[model samples]
Target: MKNLLVTGYRMNELNIFDQKNKAIVYIKRAIAGRLAPLAEEGLEWVLTPGQFGVDLWACETVIDLKRERFPQLKLGIVTAYANPEEKWKEDKQNYYRNILKDADYYGAVSNRPYEGAWQFKARDELLFRKTDGILLFYDEEMGEASPKFVKERALKLADEEGYRYIAIGADEVQSMADEERLSSFD
Candidate 1:
């Protein structure tokens, strides 16, 4: 997709470079800030409402709007994260809920509700096999994961397993990555 929205929470822990939650927040925000220029060229990255949380964007719609505004614009959607608890959340979940509804393709980085609306398990597996890009969702932030470790592990797993993205809480990024437990999606 020409545009993408990457979403997740901040890692909870503060130590462990890989697991350092603050790092995750800084990095995600940095990425979004860097991508701001792309918005002018038909791509943009938008962070979620929560601080050090999920990274999302309004690219597809922007592209569509761009197209409507400037017919020559080309566009696509590439979602990077989703929550397993999405089906259960009440008020704050609507934005995510809408992402699922509007997404053209899922990142499949973790488990998600199949009955709600979008169900891409099979497609996710196929994508994973090809190592192209699969749906991604961060697991909960553990009390002791490191940030660098999280990025390292995620990079390794994504390389080996064909994941498009890995979701991590602001506090758990590094440590969680090092922990590398089986994602519920698996």
Candidate 2:
């Protein structure tokens, strides 16, 4: 069985509420569609950063998929440091806690407090080393600086490690929908 790492932009970066949350809907559908084949192809675990947007969405999707089809699928929430959400608002912290509670495994790459960018890099490298593949949701135009940097690093590491890399952006989602529509007429 293969383990997959998931990464992507946060809600604030995606302008999630701009289109009546259509972007979020698209992201969920796209991720689910991509994950279906992977699950069927022996995907056993999904590792996520436990962030508020793509990571959380992927974790939820994996949980749903486990209930609906892939019974053996498991989720792991990986953080850069212990209590990573310490500075977040109450609601955000609650959400993060709930996600960790629902996960099959949860741990931080660093046992100590977050030092700086190094901790984040360490976490990213740890995720890359632990998983067989990566599922990334990214868009260059989104202006999500951190996610974009992570995506680039993941891609580079994946290439070096021969790990499978799957990416879905807003354009890809639109293209997929267009392809489906075109296929319906065939």
Candidate 3:
């Protein structure tokens, strides 16, 4: 896929209140593991809805990939509405600002401040229309949060148009953590 939309749990949804949380390392590793091969196969762009957990981390992973391996990869952050970081703490806002500064493209789907849930639905439709595929960090049992909407929409689109969709489940993330632990002893 040329363009892929990546999204998942928000910080609050995942109960990760800070960037220094140890789980972030494994989460990012999972994203990078899946993304590297896609990049090798001509994935040029990674896009996110800027939900600020898995979404922002996915963009960060793309940046890491560009630095460490695939320089051809680009990052995009399109939020559902404007000023996505307005309510966030200063540190989180700064973190998001840095990502936006480094992004190849950054903007909002609605271009206005939050009005209602319809804005997010508009974002989902816009993402489905723009990207060729998706890399979602979601699982059915624990994915009753915002990611569910995106996942559901992506699955329907995949059924209709064969749109490529990859979901990273909790078990896969746990396995990556286990693999890292074992490799550290080697």
* Top-lDDT structure, candidate number: 3
Which lDDT tens digits does candidate 2 get at residues 86-124?
998888778777777779999998889878988888888
After superposing candidate 2, which stretches have Cα over 4 Å from the reference?
A: 17-20, 174-186
Cα-based lDDT at residue 55, candidate 1: 32
**Candidate 3 per-residue C-alpha lDDT over 46-153 given as tens digits, one digit per residue, 9 for 90 to 100:** 889988899989889999999999989999888889998999889999998998888999888888899999988888888889899999988787748878878888
**lDDT, each prediction:** 0.38, 0.82, 0.89
Clashing pairs in 3: none
| Count of clashing pairs, candidate 2 | 0
Candidate rank order under TM-score: 3, 2, 1
Return the TM-score for each candidate structure: 0.33, 0.85, 0.95
Range of the 10 consecutive residues with the lowest summed lDDT in candidate 3: 138-147
Q: Between the candidate structures 2 and 3, which one is better when assessed by TM-score?
A: 3
Candidate 1 Cα misplacement greater than 4 A, ranges: 1-8, 11-29, 37-52, 56-83, 107-149, 154-186
> Residue by residue across 72-166, what tens digits does model 1's lDDT show?
33323332234543554464365455554543444543344344423333432333343332122343344333234334544675677654453
Give the Å shift of residue 15 in candidate 3.
1.8
**Ranking of all predicted structures according to lDDT, beginning with the best and ending with the worst:** 3, 2, 1
